[model samples]
Target: MLLNNLNNDQGFRNFYMNKRGPIINHLCFDDDVILFSSGNRKSLKRIMRTLKTYEDVSGQLVNKHKSSVILHDKACARRIDRAKRITTMKQECFPINYLGCPLYLGRKRISTFSVTVQKILNKIRGWFFKFLSVGGKSVLIKHVLQAMPSHLLAVMQPPKTVFEIIENAFNRFLWSGSDGNKKLHWSSWDNLSYPINDGGANFRKLADISKAFTTKHWWKLRTKRYLWSLFLNTKYCSRIHPVTNKWRNGQSHNWKAMCSIKVLVENNLGWIIEKGEVAFWYDNWTDLGPLYKFLDPDSKPSKLRITDAYQNGHWNWPACGYVVSDFIKAHIERMQVVLSDKPDLPIWKITSSGKFNIESAWNFLRNSRHESNIVNALCHKAVPFKMSFMAWRVFHRKIPSNDIIISWFKLLASPNCTCCRVSQPENIDHIFFQSYVASSA
Candidate 1:
């Protein structure tokens, strides 16, 4: 029975014992054993008797070590010892030179391990050169050859630095873009135009070459070559603008426009104009209050001041209030006709009513009647309550009426109602209800 199947049988040992015969020499279940002798019937009977006697006295079978075998031979043992000695000798003589150093391999007589190491180093060097392309291949090749050892001639050799490898690779192809013998034409004023015997011919030659290389014609011819080299070598060259002292191909139109405005103001009006005025004048010619102030403040009948509010906040403009007042007054006076006509327009329909002043009209439209009442009635409401009220009072210049306040609250309480939707949203409410009607009507 298979070892795994033995678990099902209760008397597996007894079953095996029943099957024992003359041909069977031994039986073992783990460490326990039974031995049989089958040389002759007489010897077998003697062995069986000894086994039975042993079972009765000690309850164990005969040990094979203590039992004698009739056919023990010396020749088989001698042959096995000789075969083991031969195998050991062959193992000792196995070739180790076949697996050389891994650093240098494939090109010369370096070890395999040395060849592999060299290959790895080459890869690293190549990556470095890919970023820093500066020199020629010959320079790198010379340095590498000098560094390489003399002994590694068969297995492999180290490659030159990445720079050299790339140079050599491109050198193999004849690039049409590369200049062969086309000499740059030197002008008569160039130093190189005269012979070296002349006093400044050498200096002239240097200057001429520099100018030729920098000139439009020569540059056009070499542009492709120079760009190609730059791409392959991963090197970049840059030029700077003379006037701006910045690296750029073209001037900023914004700066140019500003300069032009400054020049025009200085030449025509004898004034120093601000950048804002320049921009404003450029956008709309009639909107020239600031420009007029900059040009001839004395000539203008109205007092005018120009203030930068943000700059004043930072203490950048000291007389900001005066400037702002003057600038605003001047701006209004300049557009006096337009301002006077504004009231006649539909936009000032509320002002045309003559009941409420401009400030009152602004206040009435600024806050929803409901929101204002909610804040006034409930002191427990958030701080935004007092803040909103204060802002309206300070900016709009009037307290809201109770009717307007109650209507605002009703609108807020309504659900999905048109009056609520139109009036409840505060900014939209202020715009359509107040500002838009006043400005457009």
Candidate 2:
């Protein structure tokens, strides 16, 4: 309300967002506020007056010590000193930590996101990973370590180096159970991160997890009704809807992260047609996707609503501008459009309820990557996981057996059955069957 009055008074002007982009005056979340404005003495003094008025009315004082002024490097000396005197706050640099996440301009550096990697390590501090069994360690990594980067990854596209450093920590903890000690990782992460059915250890990769969830943020832009979403739509996605938006230069990193999985979002999205509120030409209301694709470049209908052709529980065939082929008719016939007072909703086709979920997104992204019936056989519920863990290793030939070691290290000594001291290739078959101890048993 105060901002509305200020705009009306014409006392302050917001900073330009991008090249011909929306003017974002401020972004407020919880108790924190991020104000954006053109650097000028008049606007700076106006902001100070507004803050003073807010403190007077609300009885909540603004902390000058906690706040700092930041200006563009090109901001003139007079404007900087005037801004400092008016705002009564010291000037700070880029990459200020606010609300526990770093906010900065331009490209991210190693030190920029290094704080996130340290946060993951902090979660595992004081733990004796060396003593934990394989099963116990797996549980901790999945539940604790893996969850550490989720919030940051959701907010921004994380650096590939950040993912690598964190994954290396997971590998170090899983194999040696200690950061200092060296141990052989019998299987590569690609093999180990696959589901149990695929003969893997069922560890999820952080990169895949991040990619699957990038679409979730885009899903919220259209589906969620919130103040931030309103501003986001006004500021960034006004001219183009998120699903169909092609890339453009000078876009924000947050928007770039959401666009990373544009294909997945477009393909998996389904529309719940109610009152024909969805766009007929652009929305994916049919299995063949948007109806616009079927028409010629010059002939596609403009401003045509689905309700224009829908009547009396059937499609009015002549209402369409283009020829409706038998193939197109078949797809349209299968669509169930319900007329109700409820507003139209976009559905995430990956889930049954038409709602987006992280687990379902992950499952959809990771689906068919691995399929093995051995999941039921190798992992048992009632027994100790130590035994199950060993059985899992043995089944995948991941144990440090002489045969496996010989393949990896190529020891100078010829392979022998270490258990029976037999002069033969120390292979899984010979050690388990042909040895005297196994033959007599």
Candidate 3:
């Protein structure tokens, strides 16, 4: 019926889409209907008349007062007043929240979402994290504090200042002594963001969290076929299909963030070579990295799919224009290939489950580099969270011994081991091994 009206009514002008023919200027999801028309009195009246006619026939009333007009560009006051008179609706204010997204024209500022910042601070101020054990604090930080700003992060990436404020609150809560006194920081923020077994407390990093959410959006764009994706396809990616086209800068902040994360996803994603969607030379199909990297830098590149390197469902090494190394040959031999009618698919290599998730993304970011094998030894089923945290402190040599405390605050003139009444400084090695009490115990 909407399409019929667009075809028949001369007053109705379809929205001009760049990639395709004009489309109907309306969006209806469930019970909500948002109608779009040109910024003119005639078009507004036509839409109002159409809505009234539909309502009269369907036994429903048009709520004119509840409706609003939101203009992105600056318009003359008289023009806006005329639009208001035509539609009998008020103009919405800028920076209004629509469907949980802040809509405004111009560069994003931290103060654009001041309400979110206050909420985080209020939640932190109410908590008494000092009374809790290290493990307890860890659990609360993961389950409560980290999860607090999740809705905001999903739609809009918060500024660095916002992230820092939240992280500072977490840091103060993590290291508060009795009666709200400050305690010495045992480890750096970067080390604490690692997994528990990696000699630091496992805390959520906002930067990584932001990247993960944006990456999930990219995953949805690739896997889900919907009206929104179709609109994106028509507007930004009409010339080339997403699989083959390089990412471009997006006009919107959300799209730009997704493009940045898409680069990160490219490195961790592997192809499940079915029907040769996987590029032979560029994609990570074989156990080895992209085959193009092995070729001489002077060699010209070509668009080669994985199927090109197969003949009669067997390996065809000569198809590649490079001299195949023995190592590459062995790696190819181990890769099982079964050609079928299915198209190729992508798998997240960081996860054993072959799916994209927040946990897998966090683990990838946390342990991808500088991983310590001591994680295996430090993490045991029998150890409690507090004990494990203490052991981690010991491993990092971060215990607040007398010598370190004195140096950190200049509390004492001497660096003597108080427990043993010795003149030597009290360090990790001395407190744990050299002291008379420690040796006796």
Candidate 4:
């Protein structure tokens, strides 16, 4: 309603988008208002007046101090000063932190994402992570440490170095502890990244989480009528199909990040082939996977459709030039295609219901290669965290027994069993099983 009044005002003008696009003067969510302007002094005054009027009508105060008027870098000094005076808000530059996310132009830099790293550090600096056991650290990593940077990861693809820094912090906190003392890590971070059911500490990689977020955004863009989706579609792919559109080199950081996960999306995105609009080689309508994958990686893909391969209601692979093995060919040959009036729609292949969900997307994108293991039982609520850590240490042969310490430290000491009269090496096996005292106990 405020925007409508602003548009009607003779002094107001919108930011120049493409010639054929939505008339987006400004957009707001909650108290966050992202205003677009043509940088006219009269226009800025009009916008403030409109805001003031809206506040009067809706009983919502428009705090000028909380708002900002950001102008293009090339704008003249006079325009900048005029904007500052008109809005009475802070004058800031690009690469600024807006609502906890960086709004930057061109390539995103490390400095642009420094706030997230700082936030993560601030969240953990007060806690004594070194005093915590493996179980305690595991819980903190999942529920606290990892969750800190998730908001930033979902929106921005920070540099590889940033991810490494955050990961290094996680490694130090979990293995070496917060005291900064070096310690032997009993398990590799990769192993620790798996879920408790899969015998890991559940310290997931933020990189994977970022990919899941990108995939979620892609799914929304393709399937939903969201505001951001509409804006992005208008700006980048107004005419072309969202899935098939080839990304130009000049695009934003998030767009490139979204493009980087195309293969992951294709693997799980199925088609509801109705009008047969899905590409024959590019799409996965046949359920055997993208036919393009079966072809040579360097082969120039020929443009075709699902309807092209069918003649008189029968599947023919050779007719489509998709030279797959007889097994794959036979699989597609037996499959039936039912043509309908509706267009092809994308579906999440992970579930039968055809709805895209974050959990399914995360599981698929994370590429869980885990199997059931002892960690499941060890992670029970009744078991103590330290005891669980001890059991894991014993299982991995990392316990500081006499034989282990002597052999591991490259120093010779008494190798005989200390628990019994039986003169046997005090190894993990003997200490736990072979010794008479151990067996009797």
Candidate 5:
């Protein structure tokens, strides 16, 4: 088959070369065809007839529907109707589907062509998904659902209860996992981790409590009668009030805090001791002895004092200052410090006089080598900011490439790409040149 294809390609090339004088370029890939020529309409018609004859002899009929003929000029190539041929010479416009994209003829700019191409491609994709089965339909639905507005999604309310939500999510999973007509095995609700029988009593109790809480009578009783209302409200509280011995305050006091700690010890011992391996720390405290033993072996009175000092505040002290942009600035600062100290470094140097413009300093360092050591150092430090200005200077300084201007306009127009939601400094390679799945726009 490979030999046959090679011979066929050679034969076609030779035939076009020998017989067609006006044929400038021709390309064929398997059954697909693209032919270029610098001939008048009469000559092109003659060539087409000859090709048809050859196809008839070779038992490969030409798909005129898929074939096209355009005059050799940028305007003609741009104006040619790829989908439907122009029957009249006066017709200035035609429609074509180039590379699975519908394009209107007579578009003067390449940018417009690209936009039209993308639109048609998306339309084709929509059509393809529409023709698919229930499972495929569900996938498209999921995609659409993800793209929907958050407010609209909330209002839709597909599932109200936890059980209903779980059931709906499982149904979606089942549909996605199997193809059409293939059955999915679902165990009885009894076989679930929390069986319906066990959950029923809890659910009913919760429903009754919720009903009582939201009732007009409960609200009136709490508001109309002051002392009785305070007492009734006190029963709902989890914290013991300072003035009243009853649990009456909204905030969690020492007693409630201890209760929470007890619950954590009872419920999360496996997580703390085995998974986190905090048994060393757990052993020191009697109530939470196992957890303390796993967490810290030497957790005596002295170590507890240090731990209390560190854990006094709600948030961790070390992590409090570590914002996303701080990481980038820290990396840049570290690279600058390292490069300034190195006397013989090719891509960096500290002037006898200190100048503090970041861009200028970067340029001076970049001028010393093809590979920017400062930028490389920043990369080593795991900084997310790309050396975009340097890349722009290399690619767009000499030749005024509109691609670069378009890129700049795009970046300036929006900090984030429309498709992938990644923020700038995004390059053309990251946006369009790479795989579409990975591309930002």
Candidate 6:
């Protein structure tokens, strides 16, 4: 009903996309109602009148005192005052939290997203991790600490320092004892973040997770026609191509940060050009990258689409005069080009399923190029968590081992091997194997 009245009002104008399609001015999900309009006296009056009408017809009164007006444009101070006077509601400032997310007119600041960090810290500080076993603590780290930032990361990209802070807190929680005394970290965070199959603790890396999520969001923007996607496309990415466009620093920090993962996405993003509509020079349809890059410099760039290689939904070999090399010929022949009537499908290359999901993205980001089997015993499922952790320490040469405890961390007083009652240096080798008592055992 409010929409109807607002639509009829000649003076009212809602935000439009590309100056072509009309965007809805009001959005109501459950009890949360958000009304948006141009910052003008006429538009504001129309909105207020529509709300008043809705109240009268529905027998529900809007609490004007609770509802505050926020103006995006500071230049419209007079108009803002008029709206405030007409509605008898207070005018709120920008950078205020709306439904747990910070809303502001300009670039995002680290300070704006500090709430998420504080929330995570508060949760960690209150937890009784002392009673939990290593396995239980690992579960908490994965499900609780890692999950805390997901909701925020889904919508916006926090600063790099934010992730560093988060990871530091995680490190303390994992390594510190129940009494809060610091213990030696078994492995570097990078090594511990690898997959279980690859001999890691399977812990997620903060920076990588953030990048994967942001990249996944970018994928959605390309494939999905959401209102936010449409708005962003019409506003920011209208002139820029997805693969080649560089994110400018002056743009919205949220978008700039999101687009920062474009290179990673491009490296892994593949397409099934069923209709052959892909751009021959730019699109990643072939495994060898853009065909233009492989071509001789003397060869003039052709305006040929991939469709030119086909005639009546069948591969036309004679028409592909551009294919000069025997390798190109074999590559094309090997390609199962069943030209379907359906549009092309974009896929994530790292995943076996070929769909872009957060889990797959995270896995791609955390995957190590070098595979090692030496740590497999340490990460084996049969091993207890504390033993596995200890094994990790031994693998990384981080065990306290008397001398290290005495010298490096300065927690212990003596360097003698206590188990063997010998003056020999109590290094890892001596404590575990070389000592008299250890050898006897």
Please write out the lDDT profile of model 6 over residues 1-441, one tens digit for every residue: 667568777788776546744466887878778888777778877788888888899999998877987776655667877778976889888777777677776765778877888988888787655666677778889998998888777777777788888888887777777766667765566677877667678787877777777887788776667877787777775654455556775677667866777767777777887877765555678777666567776664454567886676566655654664678667866886777778888888888888888888877666574545767866687888778867767776777677666676667477776656547878888877898877889
CA RMSD (A), model 3: 5.6
Candidate 3 on 85-174: residue-level lDDT in tens?
A: 888888987787665556665678877767777777787667664577777777888898898788878767877887887888788777
Report clashes for each candidate as comma-separated counts.
Answer: 39, 0, 0, 0, 20, 0
Q: Quick one: ranking by TM-score, best first? A: 2, 6, 4, 3, 5, 1
* TM-score of every candidate relative to the true structure: 0.13, 0.85, 0.73, 0.79, 0.20, 0.82
Tens digit of per-residue lDDT, candidate 4, span 19-130: 6666778777787878888878788888888888888899989776776778888989998888888788888889888778888887768888898888887766666544
By TM-score, the best candidate is 2
lDDT of 5 by residue, 1-441 (tens): 222232234223322332312223445657765554434444344445566567777887766654555442455443454312332222223444444433343322334234333443353344442435443443443344222222212111111242233333333332333332333323222222121222110011111222222222222322244543444334432242211223324532322332322322222222111121112122221232232223234433111211232233222324322232454334423432211222221111133332223333222222121334543443332322223222322332322234454554563343344455444433555453553565434
Query: Which regions of candidate 5 deviate over 4 angstroms?
Result: 1-30, 36-45, 71-111, 116-378, 381-441
Candidate 1 at 119: error in angstroms? 2.4
Best first by lDDT, ranked: 4, 2, 6, 3, 5, 1
Best by lDDT: 4
Tens digits of per-residue lDDT for model 2, 1-441 = 665456555767767545454456667888878777778777877778888899999999989999898998778888888888888899987887777677788887767887878887776564654577778888998888888778777777767888888888888777874554768887667667766556566678887788777777777776776765666776776666555565567767777877777667778887777878666676787867877777886663654568888888898878877777888888788866767777777888877787888888877777455444565476555546667667777667777667788778987766776567557767666756777776888
Cα-lDDT of candidate 4 = 0.75
Model 4 is weakest, by summed lDDT over 10 consecutive residues, at 367-376
- Taken over the whole model, the C-alpha lDDT of each candidate is 0.30, 0.74, 0.72, 0.75, 0.32, 0.74
Candidate 1 lDDT over residue span 205-315, tens digit each: 221221222222211211224532333222112221111122233433222222322322222121122322212211122234233344334332222122232232232
Cα error, candidate 5, residue 241 (Å):
96
Off by over 4 Å in 1: 1-130, 134-138, 154-441
List candidate 4 stretches off by more than 4 Å: 8-11, 129-131, 176-182, 273-345, 370-385, 401-426, 435-437
Please identify which of the two predictions, 3 or 5, would achieve the higher TM-score against the true structure.
Answer: 3
RMSD of each: 46.0, 3.5, 5.6, 4.9, 36.9, 4.3
